[model samples]
Target: MSTTTPAKVTVITHPLVQHKLTLMRKKESSTNSFRRLLGELSTLMAYEITRDMPLQDLEIETPMEKMTGKVIDGKKQVLVSILRAGNGFLDGMLNVIPGARIGHIGLYRDPETLQPVEYYFKMPSEMQERDIIVVDPMLATGNSAVAAVERLKQLQPRSIKFVCLLAAPEGVATMQKMHPDVPIFTAAIDRELNDHGYIMPGLGDAGDRIFGTK
Candidate 1:
């Protein structure tokens, strides 16, 4: 359930991300606020996720003269939502990368052993040549994230990254070990996980709050 190994676990903790995550954590917050907060946090995560994306120069004609314009290089970035909660993050990621291709990897965790088993998976047209960024709101047990990434690996994506609203230490460690190649970007890493695999002092179910299905 943990890894003492040093891994690339990034804590966003940006003011905007923090402020929204706080509001989403409150018991009184409404569904609208929860959805808004998730979008805000997801935007911040998207920024970090694409920080080092390769870029190329393109010829462009300006009002004055022809010049070079920046284009997303062959990085071929694609957004893949992990389903349900992952859609929350996808909403914001799309805002930033308008033309980016989209993908979906749906997995539901088994309540008994807390393992992620894929029920459905549909990725972008060409995943092997692209770098996939998988989105999910909560990383409590890390089972879902790891399993999703494991499935993604079979697609032969050049690289992968994980984006989440919040995470527990146990989950972060587990994911890092399971997929050392995939860097994690999250709004916060909470203290611990509770008995039922929920983040400690963490916001209740993100899916319920965002969709108001509770």
Candidate 2:
């Protein structure tokens, strides 16, 4: 939300998205409710994220007559999950874009250094022709997101976007400094990150909440 930064960060202010996010953030929110809300929220967010996807004119026959209509080719789009937490966003997005290819990058934050350590990565072929949308629940430190994007750039995808449930100003700034070309979309932008690399007032440890690990 900082105006001084050049990063193309969009804070989704849709009423439904904000409502579900509030439900997900409550400490008393059960794992089931939290997970369900995340899926519903992701579906809403996908609507905004893919708003400008390139559309082509297609002739289609309706009940009465044939007409030209705009259509998006789902095959040219890919959703890349940033490991365990990112998978949570998959179901909802897939509901909207069922034909989109899926990819995964396994990364864990180094406890001591607060950096990302990649353990696995798998992507679909012909990535150069696909527009990539990277999903992760929280962008707190931004190290993992940065590292993941750096790796994906090697595949040279046509375009890339990062979507998350929440983001911290520090994370936004870090991403701006590192990968300004990749736009970031999030439900809300929190104030800042705590010393432990957790977003203040953020839904704590998204992976834990999603999986009930904690």
Candidate 3:
């Protein structure tokens, strides 16, 4: 196991992200309210995560003038959602980068072993030329995040960034061990995970709350 510290974890401290996360954490927050807050929060987080995207100068004509302006370079970016809950982040991110290609990785954690089990996965082609962003709402045990990244690494994307609404220290450590090169972006890093592997002080089961399945 790698002993390197997780230096790539980015905790989003934007006031809006922090405020919206607070609302989502409330146990009494309604499903609609929670989902709405999550969408808004995801948009904010997306902005932060894409801060370093490459830009290129392009000559364009404006209403009355032609000027060189900067535009995102290269092909449309890719957003891979670790399915079910990861879908919650899609709308907000797509709203920002409407042309981004969408990918899905379906996996569930086995209760007995607390390990991720993959069920489905599909990604856009030409991954080597495009950066990929993997979105999931929670990184509790990091099993799913690690598994998803491991699978994506096989495709050899130009880059990979992991985004989550919440994360735990244990999860961050696990990800650092497995894929330290992949940075982690999240709104908050909550307290430790409980025995059942739920992040304490987290917004409960994210998939359950997002879909009101609980």
Candidate 4:
């Protein structure tokens, strides 16, 4: 196995993930449909990414006899939502990993500066010992996602993986160069970024649909 951290991102292109992603990508998709699809897509992708989590065997008493059971080992995994958009992905992930601890970091871009600014932050205590999965729906500019990871590092989590709904290659490249130690998992990696820095053919803003607010 490679000792180095994975810099590459695995786009969860499974049929179900792809179908839902396609629906969300359409300009004709309504807010309710987009929001519902995003949640479902997150659950599908999260399952694949979390498949290899270490498990420990435990002996259990059954009605007929004693049996062996497997349970996740080590500390509970931490799922951090990078604000409004991230919350969309976080909801589905939480459904799958109901017992996993959750964290939230709210970052928004400033109008004139076009810089990511943190509006709120909270993370599990003793996070250094747990696996961390930071989530956001869109990685358009990568500013907020990068900033969120930078902040998480200050707490020194054992390991971190970023999960997003869609990513532009530019954003992926930026994150790869800035924090090569972090691996990214996204549902789709779009072709390019427009001059305005939005992912080309990207779905409308994830936050708006998820919360039904502008």
Report the lDDT tens digits of candidate 4 across residue range 1-93.
123654768888799999998888887788888888888888898898797777889999989999999987434699999887787787788
TM-score of each: 0.93, 0.96, 0.95, 0.92
What are the RMSD figures for all models against the true structure? 3.0, 2.7, 2.2, 2.2
User: Candidate 3 residues 113-199, lDDT tens each?
Assistant: 899999999998888888999999999999999999999988888888999999999999998888988899999898899999999
Misplaced by over 4 Å in model 2 are 1-5
Evaluated at residue 143, the lDDT of candidate 3 is 95
lDDT of each: 0.83, 0.94, 0.91, 0.83
Tell how far residue 116 is off in model 1, in angstroms: 1.4
Runs in model 3 with CA error above 4 Å? 1-7
lDDT per residue for candidate 1 within 1-214, as digits (tens), equals 1235544878886787788788889999999988887887787767877888888889999899999989884338788888888888877887777767778888887888888878888877777789888888888999999988888888888888888888999998898778776788888889999888989899998888878999
Inter-residue clash pairs, candidate 2 = none
User: How accurate locally is residue 46 in candidate 1, as Cα lDDT from 0 to 100?
Assistant: 76
* Best candidate (score: TM-score): 2
Query: In candidate 3, how many Å is residue 81 off?
Result: 0.3
| Total backbone collisions, model 3 | 0
